[model samples]
Target chain A: MRVSELVACTGVPLATVKYYLREGLLMPGEATSATQARYGEEHVRRLGLVKALAGAGLPIPRIRKVLQLIDHPDGSLFEVLGQAIGQLPPYLDIPADPGDYPRARAVLEKLGQIYDPRYVAVAQLERALEALEDAGIPMTEERLDAYGRHIRGIAEVDIGLMPTGSAEDAVRCAVLGTAIYEPVIAAMRRLAHQDIAQNFFQKTDEQDAS
Target chain B: MRVSELVACTGVPLATVKYYLREGLLMPGEATSATQARYGEEHVRRLGLVKALAGAGLPIPRIRKVLQLIDHPDGSLFEVLGQAIGQLPPYLDIPADPGDYPRARAVLEKLGQIYDPRYVAVAQLERALEALEDAGIPMTEERLDAYGRHIRGIAEVDIGLMPTGSAEDAVRCAVLGTAIYEPVIAAMRRLAHQDIAQNFFQKTDEQDAS
Candidate 1:
């Protein structure tokens, strides 16, 4: 298939395909002649995987590293996924001046997840707490514990889905799911909040009217 | 405090303060003369909120809308949050072609949450399912239901946290948490996967070695 066919079939733009060629993310097709090349099924499959991973929010350079792993015959599937996910930019990049690490550590311990404060996840959680405090919201011990319980539920679901596939096949699934599910889940949460808030607010309005 | 003082006090750069001023996301300080403006406590609070929300991934225009709500006394607290969250760009914006709404609706029905297909949340769910199918992964009803269970847990945490304050006070909390928590939660899930994958892979290695 021609490069244009590749684009038309994959629904990716021509410039992006060219950019991928330049970045060495997608190898050049069979050179039919000067200025023309024929792509194949292999190129099509690779392009699909690349698009899915990129869509999930992985940076181009990191996506390169992941593609390298996917190409390696002996690459551990989980390792590929770990690299894909582990490279995610930290949740919050705030400085340590006013952050309460002791509290964050305590919360992590209470939740049974032992991670260093430097772990991006822990740092991210600390930033959330700090932002809440800065905004005058409390992070009482009881509240943190309750929040932890729910996070554990979400984690279990993510982990549970892991055993469902062989490593190579599952990498794309995880890559896309990681990129996709959060927005879906978060949106659902927002809609759910809207439902609850409407109920509560409606009752308040009625009381006020009375 | 003068404009410089506002910068000094908030720790945000002078250019950012000026940019926010230009964007109208931040109200100008009390002007004693041309090129001289004195900020106050209100400026400090608003600047902090703006920085936190922007850090969370809310765009400038969306931040402007949120700020407008925060300044309006009669703005419903949930409404303020609805806009803040409602403005979140969907994870994937693929055209609705080939997306299985019937499957998505079934998943939602199984989860006991009936939402319209046009709802951003429902549409986001549809996109995720489409990505999974495109990747050749099974979207079994049971798996989605299990995923839903976890999402329900996370949403419960979010809704529980809502009663912490009146709407305005909670807006900053939600803004930061919304901007911050998903990344954090997603990272935690990744970390958890690494842990489990390590265990599974290690056992396999032992079996091979033996």
Candidate 2:
């Protein structure tokens, strides 16, 4: 397919397709002529994946890293998953010493999860807990464990959704599933708050009116 | 307390605190002299909230909107909560016609939640579902409900944490809790994925070695 056909098939703009090519996000097409090239099925599929990752709110550089993982499977799904999590953004500034995040460590210990100090999410979790504490909303062990139990269920659903086709499929599923479904999950939590609050506060408003 | 004391107390730097004042994210301190001003405990509290929201990755505009809701309450908790949800970011590009988002509507309807078209989260949920569909990982009603159930539990925890002191306190808790705790929840989800994946995948690796 020509570039025009690729754009039509994928619904990506011509300029964006060009941008992806220049940024090395999309693979180059076959050289049909000096000024022309033909894209194949792989190009079309790759464009779709790129669009999905972008829509998942990943920056271009991180998307490129995820694509690198997908393109070359190290055959260790665990390592690939770690590398993918490391790519998720908002990497916080960690302290020079690991001992500063006692709240984060304590919560992880309470849950019996191994606290790999190098994992980006652990550091992020620690930072968030610190901010929450500073904001005067400390997370009790019970609260953190409650979140852990519920989130563990959600994670099982996440792992169940993993494709068994190939290592490539597994990596694609993990990366996309993690990034994309997060906002959906967060939105659901907000909506649930609205629902429960309406049931409680709205009813109180009505009762007061009566 | 002086501006420097406020900074020392809150740990927000002078320039950044001044920037917040300039941006109207923080209120002006009472002018005590031509060059100096006095801040109070309220300023200290507000700065903490601002830092928490910023740490939650909310931008200036959204944080300002949340502060407005907090600073002035009309005594309607439901209304304040609705306005708070409207400020969450990544408000997606919606279609011209509402009928295009059948998937989002269907999922909401199946869950028996009232679908207010004005709600921003609903639209974001629709866009995410559409992207997932386009990416060939369309959300089944079952999958969405699974997420909905778990998130609903988390939301119960959120509402349980609501401070009942003043309308201001409630708004502060709602906005700050929603924004700040989301990343923690997301990080926990990722951590749960790692834990569960280690259990399944790592055990498989060991078994193969054996």
Candidate 3:
């Protein structure tokens, strides 16, 4: 396909595609003529993936790096993704020690004792700690388990919606769901005072009516 | 507080703050001394809000405009937010008749019939149509209701972790979550394929045992 066809198929404008090309974000297609370049299936797939990553709030340079990793497949994509998203803080590394698991479990158990059962289930908590450990983050087992359980519990109770599926689906859903909902969560937080104020006035009005 | 204090409080370097001032993204604090300017509570609040907005994916110029609206309070913050986030599409301006509520309800009911109960219920589709009308987006009741229901259903199901309470918090969590989780989700998706392949191998092993 030519540039026009690419744009039509991708729903991206010609100018925007050109901008991406010029920015070195999109690789150049094979040259067909003096004024034309022909793109193929790889270009289409790459463009779609690029759009998805961009929509998910990745910076252009980071998206380029992610694409490079996907193309190579040398190491696990998990490590590449962790680096791309800046999730692995500078001090941390991946593939945590098995010895840390017991401590992490203890922390989660402590968190469970503090919060409601629905907030953080034992199973999900364990998986999250495992994931963090597998990613080689330098959390003490206790801290990892505690933080994992706390965040998970807060997330579950607060979201007011749940996914029904297998353990794998639960993990996948949690990963994707949190990604999209973060903005909505932020917007809601900004409006927190208003929500409280409105609830207060409504309560007063109800008391007067009663 | 002086620029140094502001820098310390915000964890932003002085040069970055100076860049913000030059870009007109931050306002000058009260001039207390020839060489020192005193920043007050307002600066702190505004800077914090600016940082939050920037983190939530708004560009500097758009964040500036949102801050201007908050400073003035002439219009609703909801409107400012809608504009800042580009949530209100341009096509929502087509006019509709005054008595369109019934038509809207019918469309919503039809959507409720087709989509999953959990998705439809979480969307609060009926209420959103009324909100669209209230916001003066100018759609037919049916159109408004249908679109509102559809998007809400998708968002509700797609957003995995709920931070609970406050729109701003939701948006912030969504942004950060997206930033952190996009690559994670991609990794999980790959892992899912691996799981499938593993399952297939296991089944083969079981057959051989049999």
Candidate 4:
């Protein structure tokens, strides 16, 4: 397909398509003539994935990295994805140092102490730690397990929306799942605070009435 | 406090803080001296909110709009939030034309017909419609209800980890919840697909044994 046809099919503007090509986000099609380039189905699929990643709020550079992983599909995509989702600290870059892992581990341990009675397992903790290590930040195995347990409790609630399947599906679901659920969790936390305030007020009112 | 102080207190880079001011995402503090702008606690709070919104994947312009709503805090914030969250297709953002309302309603209704019996309530549909309408999308009440039910079913399992509160909290939670949960859900879905494939081979082996 010509650039115009590609643009129409993808619902992207011609200028934007050109911009993407210039930015190296889109590969050039075969040069059919001095003025024409012929694109194929690969371009269509790649374009769609690019758009999806962009919509998911990745920057052009990061999207490029993700696209590279998609092209390779050598399990690196999962690693990149795990890093993207698990290490997200309310939207900032993950800490650069493995040394910071201890502090992160502490936070996870504290959370585990709060929720451990709910039945999160040691193996789940190991899996989460492995995921973190795979993503390039190595924490103590013990810390990772504790963190995993806490996250698992929270994740289990979130995972119910997902269809049941294998560990790999679980990993992929974890990626997309975190993308959509973080905002919801934040909102819920705010709501919880509001509820606490309401309960406090109600208790005060009851005492005054008495 | 001067811009430096604001930067120090907020833990934001001076350049980023300046960018926020230039983008109108952060309002300037009082100018105490010719060269120094003195910021106060309000600036710190506003900056935190700005950071949070930015982290939530809103662009600077969109964050500015949301800040405007926060500044006003009358009837507009609800509308702004509605617009922001309701833009997600199929999940929110019902079309405006009255003719489209029925189709929206039908879609929701069909979803409700299919999924409501399992986990969601009729009331959720009502709330969904109200939210859509409040956001200026003008979805039919019936349609809104239908979407609510569909979403509720997905949300029900996840609600275990969520903090339940009043309707206001529900809206806030829904937006943030969706943001965090989407990625996790995607990961789970992928895991499920992988599991199915693995299980298929396992089942084949089992059938041979039988």
lDDT of 3 by residue, B154-203 (tens): 23422423344555444434333322332222232222222333344456
> How would you encode candidate 2's per-residue C-alpha lDDT over A148-209 as one tens digit per residue?
88998999998987887776678778877888788788777776787788788867778889
Candidate 3 shows a clash count of 38
lDDT of each: 0.66, 0.81, 0.45, 0.47
**Chain A TM-score from candidate 1:** 0.78
Summarize candidate 2's per-residue lDDT along B1-210 as a digit string, tens digits. 999899899999999999999999988999999999999988999998888777766889988888888777554777877887577676665445657778767777777776455677777778778778888788876687788888888888888878877877887788778877887888888878888888888678888999
Provide the fnat value for model 1, as a fraction from 0 to 1.
Answer: 0.38
Q: Give the CAPRI rating of model 1.
A: acceptable
Models 1 onward score TM values of 0.75, 0.89, 0.37, 0.41
Judged by DockQ cut-offs, is candidate 3 incorrect, acceptable, medium or high?
A: incorrect
Rank by DockQ, highest first: 2, 1, 4, 3
Winning candidate number (DockQ): 2
Output DockQ, candidate 1.
Answer: 0.36
Winner of 2 and 3 under lDDT: 2
Which candidate number would show the highest TM-score if scored against the true structure? 2
Enumerate the candidates' DockQ scores in order: 0.36, 0.70, 0.06, 0.06
RMSD of 2: 2.9
TM-score, cand. 4 vs. native = 0.41
